[model samples]
Target: MGIRYVSYRVVLLITKKLGLLKNKFPTKPKQSTFITLADWKDTKAKFLIESREKLNFPKTPNKKLKEETLRILNGEICFFSYDWKNIGLDYNWITNPDTNYEYDIHLHWTDIPDFKKENGDIKYVWEKSRFAFLLKIIRFDYHFEQDNSEFVFTQIESWIDKNPINQGPNWVCSQEISLRTFNWLYALYFYQNSNALTEERFQKIMYVIYWSLQHVYNHINFSRIAVRNNHAITETLFLAISQNLFPFFNESRKWSEIGTKYFEQEIDYQIYKDGTFLQFSMNYHRVVVQLLTFGIALKEIHNQKFSKVVYDKAYKSVQFLFECMQDENGFLPNYGANDGALFFPLNEYDFRNYKPQLNTLHKLLTNENLIVNDDVYDDENWFLSNIKFENNYVPLKRTYGIFSFDFGGYYLARKQNSFTFIRCGKHKDRPSHADNLHLDVWVKGENVLLDSGSYKYNTSEKNSNYFTGTSGHNTVSLNHASQMLKGSRFIWFYWSQAQKAMWQETENEYVFEGIISAFQYLNPKTIHKRKVTVSKNEELWNVVDEVSFANTDSMQQNWHYNSDKIQFHTIELQNDIESYNSSYYGLKEKGEGISFSFNKNITTQIKYVEE
Candidate 1:
């Protein structure tokens, strides 16, 4: 680290210890009072109210969606795929249902202890506070032609009554606050015409929105400077878009201006030129895509324009994710740290499916669909687009070849029914996982040799280390240690850098070769070089791994696979072990994998076979 960055960190630590950061974000004023929309001089609330008519919501209820909505109505809240039954239909906003750990609602958000030291994960408490389920309920009500505004408004009122401004775990994260504020706005627009949306209710909701925006604005520097990733993008985009929806607020114009500036800057900084996100996670990248969708769509509605760089980055982002996609199902390789965050899920698709969000942005940018298939994912498009929903799509012609994103350090080898994905990157920003030189293979829409998904961010040391370490990926780890030195949570001492990477395609086969400087903590000379070759006609792959080091004698090569389909051919598989695979957050299943130990080099052949 440079002395400048070291000094910045030291200064931030001192300021935090001195309660300077807390002083910037003040508590809600005791005399804070709600004002009706009619009382505002310049209000765009009517535009939002009338915008509901343009929404192309599903006319009939989806059975599964209705079931989930009913469960939520019956006091069951789904947290990271686990249903916590009877979390109270009104909902307890400050309690972790998993551990029954209730946070002190009276304490300032800055006073909350880190979840690692506490009994439960703070995310579990923040989940319900995100108010994502309210969007689900609103969608359900729209589909069934039923008015659940009374219930929805009651829930919002209950949350406000419980969580004071700048207090409790819900207020700790600016990103979470942004998400909650947006979700509330979504519900408010959908229920604007309801008799249940009385003047009193509107005043209360708008008051909370005003305060939430202020909170995010005040704490914006925290995300921008310290946590410069998706969190920064989310919070900044929230402030930018909130200006359009809630112009009646006093600081809306100034907030939106600064928000627009930083939002664009963040997009340029965090989203690389090739559209791979700085965070290096498929799910986190999708989060930015959704934020882009929101920013672009909302700006268009208000007849505003962001800089051309914004559109350029959005286009590149769409193309990057599209190239990584395995098939029409929109599943990408679970290649990086995934906390299972889907900021705006407007469709009924699985969390891994990227078609809805990706296609939405692609259409917004180019007026053409990225996926020309029969699978319809128009929910997001309907919500974001001004035009009515239509199944007709002018498919954008995309040429698929060996695609390499040099800036983001991703290489893709495309064949008829399979593609090989590799990650070798120099970290201009903080890398999420120590997974340089990791490889993922997909055959016929199924991941044959896969990257083990991130299970959870905060967990037991062994689990956390396993999921984030190089051992969980299809790569070579020297001395059974990660390629980079793990520091604290989400921190690495020495970042692995890609020394050399290349991709080539001939008439018969596609090839990729990459080398990364690794394990500087052990020896600066340590390096891991990997080469992959895929046959054009046959479902076969060859991976050669070479590790050079000063002191280490043995290097371990790991591969995770769907044991039912993939078969190994060249290398002898030793230490066949059962591992945990978590495709979704808060969920893991037993998976099979094997490791090969070699002194200096090893070669492995993987082939897909019929079950």
Candidate 2:
């Protein structure tokens, strides 16, 4: 390991030690009092006294959704084609759901299974089977246009009975708990007027929420440093929303205040000044936007507010997402780490269809129409029905050839119907993918060259490595190795640094060049420089890659393309060593593109024209 790697580990150790110390110092001392008989009786009697009032649902009645709601109620639940029940897990509700769960006796939390072991077979099942998302049943109420109080109550009660406090797989991560609490709160809000929300059921749900928040309060520091990405933001969002919306408990104000402070800071800290998220994943960026929407909505409801910086960051983040959006197809380029987390699946569109999220967040922020597909009623009905879409979308005016988001480290070259996105910058935080100078190209609405998005975070060791490797992206690789060395499953030891050397546009064409030497950490340093030229009038594009290395005979360079989309085009390669592309995760399709063997220098050219 290099000095940088060693220093990083040392800093990590120190931060973790400090986190441990902070854990011991609670914001307030825990209370010693227990629920007394009189208190229980009073709460029970108050809850039991039925008020003859109709529960107000968040969404207005839509008869068109009855069929879908009925299907969900009939157990035709959809979780990205993987249903929980089909995974063969028992539903006893009195014990740990994962039969193979092994609790860490000392830590008081169930240990996560090694995803690399068993060829990532166990984690594949467990990650999908974790019933945390089962709470999506609340969306059914939106469909039926009525509250399913009993259904929501039973689900929570059963979950609580099965997964004791900090003992099961669901209890392992405060992030998951926070998400569940948010969804549960949604259910309560939607079904507040239901008679099924009896005193007992309401109290039980409150107790569960209390337990979840307590776990978060105890482990906040861990989320602060180790998983300081979106996980920390989500936990704080839960604290803010819960403490603000459900303020009956004595700790609510404290929770709200702390949550708001951290959340506002994170908005500025995690999201860059130019609107790009630090995590570098488009999907994770959407998650942050979703949480922002939820948190902002709750704050509005509770008559609370965040600082102008938080709101400004949120607005810019939404605009970034809006710009990154693809043509009318609703699918943004699958760039960056994607773990298939469709947070708040309050819509019927495909998980990859980010239109719902973009539209929802845009409306939430500006109260002006961004892009409204009539088919996006589900997300709008649930989150932004109050906002009016008065303005119709006018086509975005083109601003000549090349546009670069300097702060985001992305360059967009557009000509008529073609667009290219080049990623070249040192990440602001931990990078989940080892892609440096990666390019994503699109023709009109189709993906011609794509960044085969991250498939799974934890599958087999080889797959986990391959999916995140530089070879999996449309970039240059040296010595058949990634641009940077892998530090762990989700980190690179030596982060690659990239800089734009040239960006010039002429009357007929646009030219862009970037230099990146991420492989300097290797013994004999190597550098790769790439230049892209696109003709404005012609439907043609070209790329040239030049490399400088000591042992050219031992080096390999490649240019990858989306094999699935390449079906519509013809590929010509000169001086290519080798080429292959995987259509999906864990499945590589060979002989799909060009790869090259180097001899001190190599030149490559590709022409893509619409058929």
Candidate 3:
């Protein structure tokens, strides 16, 4: 780290600390003066009163979607692909369903810790408050022509009555507050004409919205300066859109100006020139894509325009994720942190499938489709688009090739039915995982050699160490230790730097070679250099890992795979071990792996065939 960067970080830390001190004495919003729908019509804000008529849904309700919606209506909440049933009709907004622990609702937001010191992960409490599932409920009503407005508004009232502004766990993070605010706005716009939206309920909802936006606006610096990643993007974009949607608010104009400027700047800074996200996580990238879809679609509807760089970066982002996508089912490599976040779930696809979000953005950008097949996911497109939804099948503009995203440190060797993804990068920003030089291979839509995904952020020390450390990745580790020294909670002491990284492609084969300076805590001169060769015709991969100047007693090579499917050669498999593989958050399954100790170098070959 340079002195200048370190000094900047220190300044940010001090600023955030001072902000928190100010937050210790918080004030609440007073009663709201009622405004009717006619009053809103008089304002210059773009009232989406026609959204219900503009949206085009499927002819019939999806059975599976109906079932899930019914389950939610029955008081069951789905978190991280698991259902917590019997949550009761009056669901407490500040309680962790998993641990049955209720956070003190009277405490100020700043007093609440991110992780509870005693019982559970605070994310459990924050998940339902995100209001993502409420969007699902509204979709149900919209698709089935069911009058669930009473149920929906009742629940919204329940949440508001429970979680007061600037109080309890629900108000802890500004990003979560932004998501909740966005989702509520969606519901409000959809049900604006319904009889269930009485004047009394409208005043109550607007009061909450006004105060919530105030909280996010006041604490925007925490995300913009201290944590300059997707959080900043989400919160800033919310403010930008809210300006046009709710122009009646006092701070709407100023918030819109600042929000639009920073939101565009964040898109340029966080997404690399080659379209890879700085966070290095596939799920988080998808989150950004969804946010972009929301922002761009709304701007296009209102005939507003962002800077050209925003659209250019959005197009490049779609292209990059398109290259990484495995198939039409939209399974990308679980390469980085997987928190199982699907910001807008308008269709009944699996959580891991990303085609819906990607296809929506592509259509919004070019007025064309990225994937043309039998399956249709036009719910999100319909809600966001000004014109009616149409499935105009067009051929994909970009084809597969041996591509290198140098800025983001990802290289890909893609064929008709196979993909080889390699990670070798120097961190200009914070990295989520110690996964430098990690290799992810997929064949025929099956991940043959894979990454042990992040199970959960708040886990045991051993599990946290394994999931975020080098052992969880398919790479070489010195003395069975992580590639970099782990610090307190998402901090690394020594950042890994990649050197001499290059990719080459010939008529028959693709080759990649990279060197990463790692494990300096063990020895100052330790280095791990890796070379990968892929034969196009033979469907084979050969990896050679070499370690130099390592003073450790032993070096180990780790590989995780589905033992029943993949065939490994050119190396002796010793010390068969049981490892955990988590394709989604808060879930894990035991998998098989091999740990081979070598003096300084090792080689392995992998091949997959149809059964």
Candidate 4:
């Protein structure tokens, strides 16, 4: 290994060691403190004991937005569809809700009279039911829509009775607890004026929030990673929200103080200087945006203000969200870990469309409108309702040009009818996928070549590896091996480094040239180079791959692409290349791919004729 490679290894090892030893977060609590509330006399936590008035969710002002929200509320059996397969939820059981919760969650979605489970895994069902609590709150608050207050309270009562303090699947993860606590608090506020919210019921709900907060307090360390990414932000946002909204307890003050500090710290740390998320996954980036937007909205409604740095990073983050969209309908390049997590699924758009979030963030920060085609998006109604509205400001500007984010390792060449996004950078933070030098190409708003999204986090080991491997991306792979060495399911032993080595353009044609070290999983002396040239009209494109190695015999190089939007048999290939691709997670489709055997160089040309 060269001195540079050795230095990289040493840095990573030292980083891991420091992460393991870091312990600034709260220590795990004992059973005795599981349900305990802070003492009022504790001056250190005095702010938590102050009174907090409830805030209202935004009422629909735009007719189009209102109708959509009402349609979803009335038409669907469930307010939100948790399953992407369009499966119906079995409110009686948590499993698939449509089918059943996972075997381990040990809890049901609804309050079944005889729900029994010998073993429970809390992480399985808690994430699904997270919005369930908020849905109940909405149902009761909009009484004209539907008053399921009794059912909602019964479900809460059953959940409290079934899942004891710090026991079973529900209490297993502090992050889940933190999320649930935030939702439960909102539900309480939404239903505060309802007859169903009795004094006894209110206390029970408060007790649940208190207990959940305690769990989060005990396990805060789990959220505080060396990178301090979204997990840590979620925990801190929950703490800050809890402090501001549920200031009935004595601990709220300390939580507010510390949580706000960490919130700002994470905003500064987890968000890159270029406004990209540190995780480098578009979906996780969206999650961070949602968390930041929600935190900022909550504080704004309560008259709590973060520093200008927090607000500025948030605005730039939203700007990045807008810039990263690859299509007209707002579909982002599914270039990273995607768990089908939509923080607020108020709108019925596909998970890939990020406009809802982008518009929401725009409205929150600027106090101006973005003139979205529709107003009643779930995110819009939810977030806009929290803050006061101002003059209409439309910022959705479309342009055909080149955009480069060096820090994020993304280069985009866009035209009125085409887009080419290239990924050619090494990770400054831990990478979630083995994709290096991946390219996402789109024509006429349809993706011609793309990244296969993460289907499931946990499945058969082979399937999980397939979706995350280098082969799943639109890139060249060596001997059917990933560019990086897989360590654990989500980690790579060594990261590949790729850079935009050259870029050239003429009136009718543009070229993007890049190179990546593919030696991590192959011969240490091998290097792979790629050059892509396309016409301004997007009618013709050429890709050239060159491999430099001391010994080329018996080495295999392959390139993959997607054919979902196009007929596979129609495309002309300059070389006798085979094809393979994937549509969803954990699944692969037979498509054309190029392969070279013991060759130093190969070139492929793709021509697009008018249909």
Model 3 worst lDDT run, 10 consecutive residues: 387-396
Candidate 1: residue pairs that collide: none
Model 1 Cα lDDT, one tens digit per residue, 264-297: 9999988888888888989899889888877777
Q: What is the alpha-carbon lDDT of model 3 when measured against the actual structure?
A: 0.80
TM-score of each: 0.94, 0.82, 0.94, 0.79
Worst 10 residues of 2 by lDDT: 44-53
Candidate 2 residue spans exceeding 4 A from truth: 1-85, 88-107, 110-136, 145-148, 385-401, 550-552, 563-591
The clash count of every prediction, one per candidate, is 0, 9, 0, 22
Residues 1-611, candidate 4: write the lDDT tens digits: 34554565575557546753223222232323222223321321212111112334434343433444343344232312333232222232234332244443343211121123322222235554464435433633352355556655665666666565654456555666676665555455455456776766665666777767766765565466533568888887887766666567678788878788877888888787777777778887888887877777777666678877787777778777677675567877878877655555555555567878877777777765444566325566555564654323345466766766667677777887777777877677777787767777777766777776676555556655667887677666666677778775467867777744556788887888888776555666677788878778755667777778724344344445554333222122224444444333333456655444545665666654456
Q: Give the whole-model CA lDDT for all candidates, comma-separated.
A: 0.79, 0.62, 0.80, 0.61
Q: Write the per-residue lDDT of candidate 2 for residues 22-83, one digit (tens) a residue.
A: 35333333433333323533442211112213323344445434544554555443433232
Full ranking by lDDT: 3, 1, 2, 4
Pick the lDDT winner: 3
The Cα error of candidate 4 at residue 63, in Å, is 14
What is the per-residue lDDT of model 3 for residues 22-124, given as tens digits with 9 covering 90 to 100? 4533557568664576576345354322446556645457788799888889988788655455677888888877788888898877768776446477877
Higher-scoring candidate on lDDT, 3 or 4: 3
